[model samples]
Target: MKKMNKAEIQLLHNSIQAEAIEAMQKISEADSVWRCAYEKAPDELPPQEETEKLALLHHDFMTALTLLAVLEKTMPRNSTRESLLILSYEMFKLTCPNTFERFGCEDILKSVATLLDSIPTPEMLTAGSIDKSVHMIAKAAQYLPKIPIVPKEETPTAATVTVAKDKGKEVNINVGLHAAFAPIVPRLTVFDLSVMQAAASIYASGSKTFSTNQLYRVLTGADAHTRITSKATLEAVRKSLDTLQATIITIDAEQQAALGKYRRYDWNETTFKGYLLPMTKIETAYYSGNQLTAKCDCWRIIDTPPLLAYSKTIKQVATIPQKVKRLPRGVSATVNNICIRDTLLYYIQLNRDKGAKLNYSTLFEAAGVDTSDRISRHRMRKAVKALLQHWQEIGFIADQTDVIESSKNDTIYIS
Candidate 1:
């Protein structure tokens, strides 16, 4: 290995630093993204454009770290070695936070410092130099010195649902507005809900049956670039409509539709006026998906199933804005949006107490996923945090609207 004095050491460090100059330039972009998100509201997340930029920032950070993890074997150790190690560790910690936290960083860093000590003058450290620390962090995180979790005393509350120690056990769903429609049908998604909401909007205009075009327009905002539907957006609309029109709500949605079927029949000559209200099943809908004439492709919502079950039409619910239709994919994400929208509407339906904290189970019920048991408590906790962050990003909810997952009560306070 070649030895170096102060001039040689500084020259090498500068050259290496020049190689990763992009990281130096873009590393701090996360702060700007964070500011943009929090500027409007603490819960706000970046809009689509900013979201793309955030991805680019992370990509740059990862790219830089990939290049910097190793020391060229031919270069001898000098005073700058610790600086190199510290730079790599700091960048790894910031860019790979989940990995960092999972590894339990402090112990991992110490172990890394120890390992580097024995390696002698740079025989070329591999990428594993950082990964070695990652491995140590992972082990430290997995089997950390155990600290027993003392259970908090259970407190009596007015929440109507039963409270039992979860014990990491999946129990039958135990919360909802009615036993009939307990869980949201499994296949149903935001696409389905968006279609249903749009159809509900049309109900007032005396449109007994709505065309597919109406749904497409509402869902896609008549693209400023062109009026013709994009293939992807049209396909989404087709699937959503097909999903709703498919004579049977899948068992998953049926549980959610259970709430839909439970609505009492109101026969007012003044309102429904002898119009048949079919109740064999809560959203007993059927329609033609075959491309007939563009004008002829339409749907009859069989019966107005609970379009998210707030005892009001979609128009009556707190509007979440059509912009959210562009929100990224995932069934859970779609459900999260509905749950937040329902929180606003839920209070009105029952005249909920202002101070009462809404429990996680009830949110699951509102999302129509109460009985699905697909989403776990940990994921729900993450969803809550993301939900709040997005709200803060968009200024959708108040700053004071905080969550209470800190206790056994696992609840949300939507002020």
Candidate 2:
């Protein structure tokens, strides 16, 4: 095919988008007709012949949308990621959707996936396609999860990946080439997730409220070597508590009223989630330990005059899941070099003691890997293989000597 100029590309884009909307309308009409015909029937499934037609229509719709994603990625944009994140927010405002729905991040995944090419090889997927997106994306991602999210650890992360092409195939070239952090401020972590779980689990133990030290013991099993001693780690625990508390995720009317009764801290907005929104304003709190020296013990020693301390002591924001095992006492300032999707898989399957087989499709979608087309799916599979290999190498998962099958919709044994 000959190279098409920008105008030609734009025309093609408009054409495909029209086709996609037309297909979507046809599907809707067909479904309405089928449902009306079967309104009295108990089951909603269409007849086999109708099913086949619906499938074809769905395919056409998706193909057009996916093509649009690929084409839009090539269009020139004036904004630079090097510019201020706030300024990028301005550009995003000019182009992004005017209004956002409360639930479902589907639009974002498609847009970002469009922003990143759905290539034939894994090479591009792992590379820094997400780099420029971070400045804009982080600004927007913080607002996406205002509602309850399953396995909150699955929150989007921006981790740079670089895969080497191997003799007509892609291989585990570079999984962690940059520090990984989700766009949310206060910097939630796998460890913080466990602490939340700990707080939730302890409610069953008849504790109305829990202390950071209590969570610390549960996380590290009270091992003297791993005891929580450093302020860095202590702050991590504190931040997680404060963040979860401020978000008010539990959704009780009583707690809703008490939101600003006590001073609150505003979380900085930045994220790997698919959308963009400016961060909420900070509600300042007065606390003495804000700048404690490395060896300060003011937190441990309650003041004689009785201080109204700005502490991270959480008061039951959520319930529990399995807490992370063998957590480190102090957190390293160095950013974790891991894939965002890998982080999700690891955190959710962290305690799958007995290995389980998960379909590649399920993992692919959850990890936010693109699988819109055959080429994208092919690249996604290779990326998953590389990810699994990294897991085994890092001892996060047991060795998977059994390789992922080249066939589409392969299942992998995750341990």
- Strongest candidate by lDDT: 1
Residues 1-415 of candidate 1 have per-residue lDDT tens digits of: 3333433333233333332453445546666766767787867665767666665555444534432454433333553556655655776677677756755667446644533342222111100111000001111111111211111222211112221123453222122111122222323453455455555544432333344554454443232232432556556666655544431210112222223332232311111110111121112112212322112233433334432222232122433354432222222323344444433333422332453457777766545444445456555556556655555566655567677656577767765
Clash pairs for candidate 2 = 126-161, 138-270, 138-271, 140-276, 140-277, 183-270, 183-271
lDDT of the candidates, in the order given: 0.39, 0.36
Residue range with the least summed lDDT across 10 consecutive positions in model 2 = 301-310
Q: Write the per-residue lDDT of candidate 2 for residues 1-415, one digit (tens) a residue.
A: 2234443344334444544565688789777766765776747665777667666565445545555555667444542222222232333333333321321245434433332221101111111111000011110121222223333355423222222233464322111111123334433344443444444333333222223554444433333234344556556666655554433121112222233432244312111121111011111211222243121111110011000010112121212222223322232221121123323344334335777666766665444445688986665555556555645665766885345666475667766
Which residue segments of model 2 deviate by more than 4 Å? Answer: 1-192, 220-225, 229-231, 250-324, 327-412
The reply for model 1, stretches above 4 Å from the true place, is 1-194, 202-356, 370-377, 392-395
lDDT of 2 at 54: 69
| Model 2 lDDT, full chain set | 0.36
TM-score of each: 0.32, 0.26
For model 1 the local lDDT of residue 362 reads 72
